[model samples]
Target: EEHPDNPGARLFLGLTLAQVGDLDGASREYKESARLAPDDPFPHYFHGQALHTLDRLDMAIREYREAVKLAPQDVRMRLNLGSAYYEQGIFESAIAQYREALKLNPGDAYIHYNLGLALADQGRFEPAIAAYKESARLNPTDPLVRYALGVVQETKGRVNEAIGEFEAAAQLAPTMAAAHAKLGWLYYNKNQVPQALEHFEKASRHDPDDAQTLHGLGLAKLASGKKDEGILSLKQAYQKEEREDKKRLIRSVLVKVGALSH
Candidate 1:
């Protein structure tokens, strides 16, 4: 109130409001700050952030574009714009912005990971893998990056490579249910029942409600001759699964095993 004309004060006030979950009030102050200092990019950038959080994505994009135009060299501005584009499923625009961000700061692991995600969405598996590899190289201990790399490898039909990456991710973060679940599926497919059971059990311990883990656990148990346990696990998976096709698969397996009547 004391500094109505001060753009900096308005910007700080906007940030505080946003931090306190007063997004509507924050947006108003951000707009005022931008109006007061049209040449400054921070107000627009922060406004874009607030709009992004509110999921007003198109409006967020507009503000992000304005901020980028005012500060072309700012990597963070480009990254946030890319993420907004990604969320909108505009893969081409997201990839372009991520590439530009990479040019500004090639060493940023997160930027490379974002680029990989955009490429992967477009089914550009080769380039996606390359981007993910660079991200992993830059941040080797990041389990999410390792998990992403494993997913791409799996999609490309490189099961052994996928298993290696998933294993690394699981080792890096023991409670990473997704990685363990992927490992379980891969090992199960390779006829390694014990390994499959081990990983599936680990995944279930971490994420007890995941239907996929339950399904895999059931399959591994069946393969290993644990009839009652396998049927129980399959029943649990069938009950929890939401996808029609997956539920049908579990039902068919149960029918074939004589646990469910035709």
Candidate 2:
């Protein structure tokens, strides 16, 4: 307590508080440290982490940016900044930070995963696929990476490749509903009604509130030409669809089937 504003002591205290989930106290320590040592990035980096823990994304982003500016070669600082931007939904900024970090640590699986996420956030499916594939290759046992790769494949219209990645993700993470749903959608597109139905059902069972899988199930039922069952499934899908794209797809299908007025 001799010098509460001492940057080193404050940094350690802030870190301890952050580790124990006392974000408010951590922020206070970080602020005092930064005030005393504005030129140093340690306080700013710690402040950013504390702010992130408190869900103050905008402030967190600002602090991380300060750390990156002060410590340009510190790969961890850039990575932290990128993660903060991602939380703020600033995809371009996130990608820039991640790319900068990649230049410092090109072989890092975590960095590649971050790059993939940034690309995916901007809907850059092709680059996302490449980044995610690299992440998966670097960390083959990482279920999350496999799941991310599956998503990139799906987004890129590589349905068969997506299926393979999804299957790998499912094998690695049986509980991930998105992978199951993606596989279900791919099977539906391929006209494999039974397999599509099975994956959809699995997806629904894993995450009951997932409207996409339920909607896909409806389409699969229709693909099988069972009018009554298909109509019921479609009705459920229509009732629960929240995404604009899903709703549009449902509308187009309904119009073609004379179920909804175009």
Candidate 3:
């Protein structure tokens, strides 16, 4: 109360309130801070962050825009604004902001990764791959980046490149079920039954209830001449699958294999 007119004091109080999980109180304080220090970008930036955490994205974007206006060259402001846009599925705006951020800080690996995501979402696969490659170059050991790159490569029908990326991702994070699953599917498609089985088993160990993994395991087993085991895996996959079309597909496979009635 003694520092009622002090914007900095209100900002600190907002931070403290946020730490204590009193987001409403923090927001009120942040609002007051911004009002008191209308010319200062920090208050608006902090306010935007608080609103973003609350999932009040439209309001957050307003505050972020204000902050960006006050501090056009602040990469953090641009990045946060870009993130808000991305979460709202405003891909074009997100891409624009991310591009602006990259121009300001070209060497930022995290920004490059985010840019790749936005580009990939827009189906700009070539640019997305370029952005992901830059991010992978900047942060060589990041498994998620490798996984994302692998997914884009697979989408582009570059199976060999996808396999290499998924392999690198799996090596970096052994328990990453998605990487194992991708590797299993890729190897299965190549008729490398043993390798497919190995990866499918690893994927199943990490994500036991994944229907796609179970389906791949079933197919791999069938290809390797384990008819009964393959049929059982197919049953499990049918039971676990949530999609009607996929469940029908599994049922058809079972019926074709004489494991189910026509």
Candidate 4:
């Protein structure tokens, strides 16, 4: 308490406040620490973390840039800076930092996955697919990596490859609603109604209120000659649908089935 100018004491207090969820107090202490010890990167790094937690991403980026400048070899600092840039939708900057981090630790699957995400955000599907494939190779059992790969593959119009990845993801993580839903849609596209119905049912069971899954289930049931069940599923989907376009499609189907008037 006596040495108010002690940067170490301020830094320690900042850490304590941050741990207790007092982000505002933590920011204040961290700022004082940085001011008192301008050459120390720790205070700037911790300050960046607090700003990031508060969603002040631009300020977080500035502090992180300062910290990275002071310690260019610090992998975690580069990773956090990349993450801050990603949050701000500065995909190029995010990619640069992630690439820099990769040079420091090339085998990190999570870093590869994050790089894929940044690349994907910029609509660089081919490179994103490459990054995701590398992530999958590094983390063979990670359902999330498989799922992300499938999404990018689907975007690239590689339906069969996407189906393979989504199927693997669903098998690896049976309760993942999106994986099952994606498999169901892919099956539906292939006119494999039975297969679509199976996955759609699982998807709906996992996330009962998911309108897209319910709609797919309804369509699959209709194609398989289960008109009554299809109608019920369509009604459920309509009730939960939030998008006007989807609601309109549900209404049109209802009208065609004589469940609703023209």
Top-TM-score structure, candidate number: 4
Candidate number with greatest lDDT: 1
* Residue 43 in model 3: lDDT: 85
lDDT of 2: 0.85
TM-score against native, each model:
0.96, 0.79, 0.97, 0.98
- Tally clashes: model 1: 0
lDDT of 1 by residue, 123-210 (tens): 9999999999999999999999999999999999999999999999999999999999999999999999999999999999999999
Worst 10-residue lDDT window for candidate 2 reads 226-235
Write the candidate numbers in order of decreasing TM-score: 4, 3, 1, 2
- Across 212-238, the per-residue lDDT of candidate 3 in tens digits comes to 999999999999999999999999999
Candidate 2, residue 145: the lDDT equals 85
Question: How well does model 1 score by local distance difference test?
Answer: 0.97
Per-residue CA lDDT of model 2 for 160-229, tens digit only, reads: 8878988998888888888889889888888889999888878888987777777887788787776667
List candidate 3 segments past 4 Å from native: none
What's the residue-level lDDT of 199 in candidate 2? Answer: 86
- Model 1: lowest-lDDT 10 consecutive positions: 140-149
Model 2 CA lDDT for position 188: 83
lDDT score of model 4? 0.95
lDDT of 1 at 153: 95
